[model samples]
Target: MNKVIDINADMGEGFGRYTIADDERLLDIVTSANVACGFHAGDPRIMGLTVEKALKNHVGIGAHPGFPDLIGFGRRDMSLTPLEIKTDVLYQIGALSAFVKASGGHLQHVSPHGRLGNLAVKNREYAQAIVEAVLSFDSSLIIITEPGELAVEAEKRGLKTAVQLFADRAYNDDRTLVSRKEPGAVIHNQETVLQRCLKMVLEGTVETVSGSEIEVDGNTLCVHGDTAGSVDLAKEIKATLIEAGVEVRKLEEWL
Candidate 1:
């Protein structure tokens, strides 16, 4: 049987009249969308419009919640308590769920955005808090998190989880993503991205930027909607996966 992988993209990050991400075209190529909730990078209008677009495209809708930092784009880390994080996450998910419901769609999953996602992967306490919030809000919603760390914890707690690996981000020898501020953290070459993705799905192994190979479980693959040439890259990746006989689908559909 051909191996299958889920392709997901972050979208709907624009706030008010200001646009930030390159999602307008990226949405067409992805099977699942991580739509920005109001706290991170969206307003009510933008959220509604994004859900509508995803719904029309038959894509799975997911809430993308982040720290309340529109200025830093939610990339800057904040020293927030677990309760604080949980509260904000609930609010963001609630906001996105309302919009998705209004559009006659349902939120299929929840993926924390920016620093929140990175932090959750590295911190067990923080990751648990996030999982708790999602369960408290709605246990049926899928939890999308970094493959090894957060996914393991969520599974232990009986929450359905999808392991998300970034095709555009460099990983450490341990399979953790390199800090975004570091040089060579983000992959710019399309061929390299394609090759890495192929290895992940076919071999279940990825070579880290430091020339170390680590086993990785790629339940869902993330392509940054804001990255330059992201739309083109997504299109190419999809075609390549199909050519390799790798199934490209949403997380729910794949399982």
Candidate 2:
């Protein structure tokens, strides 16, 4: 194989009786699961159950933390102090850790969700706060994020880090993800997404929203579960990678 990578998907985003992603199906395909903590979409029971399922599927479990906005699904930006961001992240990770431990699985990574994650790409304060929390809590836990302020902060703090590339989001010329409110922010067409992935992995390039092709960096790919046809997309992406001579491996096992 010419390359080794990890396939990750967000899951456990359903609350109460509602469920989002086809997590069971995804767990079998993806090498890692970025599970939602309670603040966003999951409840205690959901979190616990997600952890158990991920463990059963031999998938690495990662804490997917975001703003405490259940209604917005943590996709909207929130105003908060550095302390608030840091503490909120720590609290969320701790909660997920409990479930992972009880389920006999180790927490492998921390991936900030939605808005918080996007902002961390450029906002130094937000990036620093998240890295500090991760360092204090579990330095061994990799921070799966795009190549930006968050990854830079993690490196400075000497914490394990993994470069993350989104399979379903468009990139800006600045290399940051385009805002969700903007046009073409999320890529939905299956063939376009597949071609984009191939270019990103095999060619190290992605066409930005401004119609510019730029170099991209990443070893971990995230296929957002909430998007329509995500389960099928994840499966195709995995098969495509394997067919292209890329090994699909877990971040915890290989990184």
Candidate 3:
């Protein structure tokens, strides 16, 4: 049997009159797109346009919900109760769902963005809140996360879950991502990123920043759209996976 993996990216992360990465080009290289839902870096127009583009490319559309911190780009931790987190997640999902629906496409998954994403890994309360929000909106929506509290709780609650491995980000011994504030947290060299991705996908493990290897089940490989040369990196990664006898497809296709 051929190995299968999903290539995903965080996209549609720009507000009105302001843009981020080249989402239009990135969509062509990725199989799944995690679209921002206005809380972090998207607006209604961007959401609609993103959904439409994903549909046209037959890419999976996922809701990327984050904290209500536009200034911080949802990367800064915010103090919020579980209820607040749950409601905020639901609101973002709903906002993106409408645009997806309008484009005749159904939302495929949910991934908490930035700080919300980092917190969901170890923070039990935040993890549960995010899982609940996803289940409440759509029982079948897949939760894209790592093998952490969020993935555990989502699976326990009978929600579909997909393990996402970051190709350009450094990881800690605990399987959590290294902070962006740390040097070498985000790998920039395309060759290095490709090698890391290939190792994670083919070996079922990743090397941590501490120079130790840990098991990693990467159902999906994520490449941040905001990263420089992301499109080219994604293209290379996908091609390399294919050349290695791996199947590259959308997450929903197998999950």
- Model 3 Cα lDDT, one tens digit per residue, 1-255: 888999999998999999989999988989999999999999999999999999999999999999999999999979999999999999999999999887788999999999999889889999999998998899999999988899999999999899999989998998888889999899898888888888999998888999999988879999888888887888899999899999999988997
List ranges where model 2 is wrong by over 4 Å.
none
Best of the candidates, lDDT: 3
lDDT for each of the candidates? Answer: 0.87, 0.91, 0.92
| Tens-digit lDDT string for candidate 1 (129-149) | 888889889888899988655
lDDT score at residue 203, model 2, on the 0-100 scale: 85
TM-score of each: 0.96, 0.97, 0.98
Q: How far is each candidate from the true structure, as Cα RMSD in Å?
A: 1.2, 1.1, 0.9
Per-residue error (Å), model 1, residue 81 = 1.3
lDDT of 2 by residue, 1-255 (tens): 378889999989999999988898989899999999998889999999999999999999999999999999998879989999999999999999999998777999999998999889889999999998898899899999988899999999898888998898999888888887898899999999988888888888999998999998787998988889988999999899889988899997777
User: Which candidate number maximizes TM-score?
Assistant: 3
Which residue pairs in model 1 clash with each other? Answer: none
Candidate 3 clashes between residue pairs 3 or more apart in a chain or in different chains: none
TM-score ranking, high to low: 3, 2, 1
TM-score-wise, the better of 1 and 2 is: 2
